[model samples]
Target: MRQLFGFLLLFATAAPLSAAEIHDDIDADTGWQVITAQAGQTKIRVVPAAGFNVFSIEHAGRELLKTPPALADLPGVSYGVPLLYPSPNRVRNAQFTFDGKTYHFDANDGTNFIHGLVHNVPWTVRRTEVDAHQAVIEAELVFAPGTKHYAAFPLEHTLRVTVTVRPEGVSWKYEVDNTHGKSKVPFGFALHPWILYQGERKNTFLTIPATQWMEAENLLPTGKLVDLEGTPFDARAAKSLEGFVIDDVYSGMQSDHPTVADFRDEGIQLSLDASDDFTHLVVYTPENKNWFCVENQTCSTDAHNLYQQGLKAESHLLVAEPGETLSGTVNYRIRDARGHKFSRWEKAIRKFEAQDRQHPPAAGGTLFVGSSSIRFWDLPKYFPDRPVVNHGFGGSQMIDSLYFADRIVLPYQPRTIVVYAGDNDIAGGQSPETVAKDFQRFARKIHAALPETKIVYIAIKPSLRRWNLYEQMAKANDLIAAFAETDERITYADIATPMLNEQGTPKPELFIKDGLHLSPAGYELWTSVIEPLLPRAN
Candidate 1:
């Protein structure tokens, strides 16, 4: 029954378990189709009549997508997530030749055609669903002869988009069919979402896993790719968007990494995960603007013209033969960092859980948990005959261990648990008293679950690189040592004392060249000090 309950719980959590709501209503004043979907902490508003744009996304009571003040102003406003199709951004000279046919567009921006023809037009709603798992709305645009959209390109096709809202996040699936066209059509697709900042724009950090940037002239791709190394345009890692003035196209997207926007002041992280079909990402951070855009595009800007000019590598233009359909998906995920204290360790915890499921570690064994010191310790090499389970995650704090105790600690039903943390907490500016209290809280939580289980608190080690913080570390160790004396099940080991030389400084042999992490000699010393305190297996 216990095993069955575990499977049921996993099934329930694998998908959204709460009821979702979605409906299509008309605006009395504007007579526009206002579709809304809500599930859990996420709510999305889509205006299908106004180009099927998702204008608003509110999560945890905070607006993540930007919108105009008045719904009437949507025709002129490009703040919402708008679909850019056929062509994205500007096309050279307002025209491109495809299959012996020259297509001409209005020169809306100087000598170039900007955006697309269908972004501000009405779309036909096809489906709306509200269920226990997700809320969804599907809309389509058919471009045929006699329609304004078809007059611009003269090619017939249909574009269907489905937007889904669940507890996890919002997703968009786009399907394009060319059965109505007489010949193959060259096209592109992209989403231009004007991402808003929760607080000051300077406090937000942006990351794009792009290896190279498209070389451009006058905001148009120049058919060249430039390496991003040592360039200001390089945002391969999380970098503050403060004082940045950028409007460029990036390519060579890393298939495994997602683009992330971290609003530090709001404690929110927005990740944009796109399918492999997307080959280019456009990052636009205008000067003095309150909003920015990280667009996911199936092809580069001016792709049709670029491909016509024999610059095929620069333009990832896709050609769909008659009756062919192309599809892709993009997801917008929001993470409330304020609520999940251990969110950064989510992947690590999941990996540990997967390992446990495969091997099924026996209960009443010794469990060691903490930060890098505990993670790097070779328990199997040191205690070869004993039953020990390592659940250490690097760079974790005392509070992190406490926050995830139920998932990683209590589930094991360990007879004894050893902890070695607080090093990072002090380095992160937490008070020594606070660190000691956090460890106390973890101990209390563990004891409450396993009344007879013993706990051993390993003293924070002294390292040459952090010798300046040794005084505060010593204070934190002393406080935790005092608390251990009050409980018979709790034990405090003094590994810090032996790690220091007669001069009261950390021994050079104990640490590597970085002077922080332990060397082989240091782990051996730690093993000698901690092994005796391990409880016997039941």
Candidate 2:
């Protein structure tokens, strides 16, 4: 039986996989296919289908991964690609012992047992025809007590795997039943798939609405939860996965249905909707690898230990009674954004514009908008003698100021407008020309609406840190000053000039540890610059 299983594995690994035989049902109520393979410039595409949306995983015009096409193909390999599993990388030891029994498993990374045994093993496939456009594949794997390497598990179980492929995307369903009469079983399971052929690493992004992350000690979960706020663990934004080496588990994920792992450059997006059972996700990106893995899981890596420690919740565990079964599903889709970029600036701009239209800026109060440096400023206390309205948001750019001008600048309708912005624009990748143009547009709009309001443009400060961009910032300040000079109502305030050291750069005393932002001394310098310009108190 062992020899037969070995022969079956060899055949499964070496069988000829047909790419051409894969039929395309484009008109069968499934969504549009956004090809990303060599033909599509590796972008994502989204199509709407009947009863569901079809998302295809493509790079250029080549298809890399898709849902199984039939119920009979339940564990079917994608284009005969090796179904990469357990954990893609090294597992510390090729054996994990539990309940006084040691189980020795196959090792791939010299240290870790990977992808579990199910991935490389072949299963009997039974296909069911559902019209010409749809089909279902059902595959089953039964493990008897004391079967070769699985002897440590010592429990009879039947695992049924189902795959449904339509024109839109693929859906996978797994049902596990304990056949051991009156005997309880202890086991852990996970699904692993490696997505490869991704284009430029810097251009690819992974987003998961996760609130907490699990820190690892040598790739083993530590059973501790860490907040995602203010850390690189936060993938709320589609940040570049380049230079990131992540092999961590994340729990407490936002219950947002259908979480997405979008790879725009590859024109592929893998979505997991295990909202009912799989609440945790593990994202793995090894340095210099061509692919990444987004594994939907019910628990962490060391779930058994976690459960023993009372760190695992009941929702994360899969327990079965006599004749009881556990089942769940994961769906994958593909989409293309057509080069449309996603940024915090764009969202902030849209929100500001909406608020501006609803409650236009008061026309003249001082507008202090920029990065964290500006937001930290206590406007009311700083300018107590003057009637000032604060419109400052931390970590904002000049473009944000322009987009949110009505909310931050124009609403106060004061006699003068003091503008403090631009630092974050430079950090956010805007050139001096871009920053100047945005500022110019904002000033023109304000002036057009309130001709009598005086415009005061504050100079972008040089931070003791982030000196690399100092020259470009200086150039930006110069352009702003030149632009302000073109109008009678516009005035330039050179706060940066006085704050600089004898060497004509920021002094360390004026900055915080990050160096890009300011210290109390920095705010004091700003106060000195504005104190003389404020109008007398009433």
Which model scores highest in lDDT? 1
**Candidate 1, which ten residues in sequence have the lowest lDDT sum?**
1-10
Each candidate's number of clashing pairs is 0, 47
Residue-level lDDT of model 2, residues 1-538, one tens digit each, is 0011221222222121111112222322222321111111221221211101122343323444443343223232232222222222223476643345555665665566654555534455444334434445455666676454245345567666665654335556777776553544444445455566445778777777777888788877677788899888888667678877788888775445666766555345656666456667778788977667677775566564455556656225455565677777776554433221323454454454465556554433455556666667887777776656555667766655654443344444556767777887786666787678667867776665467877777888888666788788889999999988889888888888888889877788888888877778888888888777655556
Query: What lDDT does model 1 reach?
Result: 0.83
Output the number of the TM-score-best candidate: 1
Assess every candidate by TM-score: 0.62, 0.47
Q: What's model 1's lDDT at 189?
A: 87
Q: Which lDDT tens digits does candidate 1 get at residues 485-525? A: 99999999999999999999999999989999999999999
Model 2: runs farther than 4 Å from truth? 1-61, 65-112, 179-181, 266-268, 338-538
RMSD of each: 13.3, 20.1
